[model samples]
Target: MESVRTCVGCRARAPRAALVRVVAIDSQVVLDERGSMPGRGAWVHRTHECVDAAIRRRAFGRALRVSGSLDTQTLQNHFQRNG
Candidate 1:
């Protein structure tokens, strides 16, 4: 069976390939394009809507199991550059 993960933004359960993996490192949220980051990770749709939703809901910290604010510039830049 295919692996499934829920989007932290939309909370929708979807195939692993349908979502992007993210990891928190040093209070910054980074996109794990290869899905091989070594830590707790969160998944979200590739769309901006979902990304913004996750930010609005403060899902990153909760999903990554971090206890403080996270810098998402890298994540935002990735979307802006490649979205």
Candidate 2:
């Protein structure tokens, strides 16, 4: 069976393949396209609404267990380009 995860943004359960995995690296929020990044991960939908909600609610830091602000510019750029 396919794995399932919850979207931090929408707080909805979805198939793992339908969500993008995000990891914290050096206080930066990076998208793990391959889902193989070495760290704790938070899942979020690729949609702008979801991404925005995640950021607005400050879910990344809480989900990833980080203690500071994280830079999500790269993640936003990625969605903007691919969206």
Query: Against the hidden reference, what TM-scores do the models get?
Result: 0.95, 0.96
Q: Runs in model 2 with CA error above 4 Å?
A: none
lDDT of 1 by residue, 7-75 (tens): 999999999999999999999999999999899999999988899899999999999999978999889
For each predicted model, how many residue pairs clash, with residues at least 3 apart or on different chains? 0, 0
* Prediction RMSDs, each to the true structure: 0.8, 0.7
Across residues 1-83, which tens digit of lDDT does each residue of candidate 2 receive? 99999999999999999999999999999999999999899999989889889999999999999998999899988988888
- How high is the lDDT of residue 69 in model 2? 97
lDDT of each: 0.93, 0.95
Candidate 1, pairs of clashing residues: none
Predicted structure 1, TM vs. truth: 0.95
Candidate 1, which ten residues in sequence have the lowest lDDT sum?
74-83
lDDT of 2 at 21: 99
Per-residue lDDT of 72 in model 1: 90
TM-score of 2: 0.96
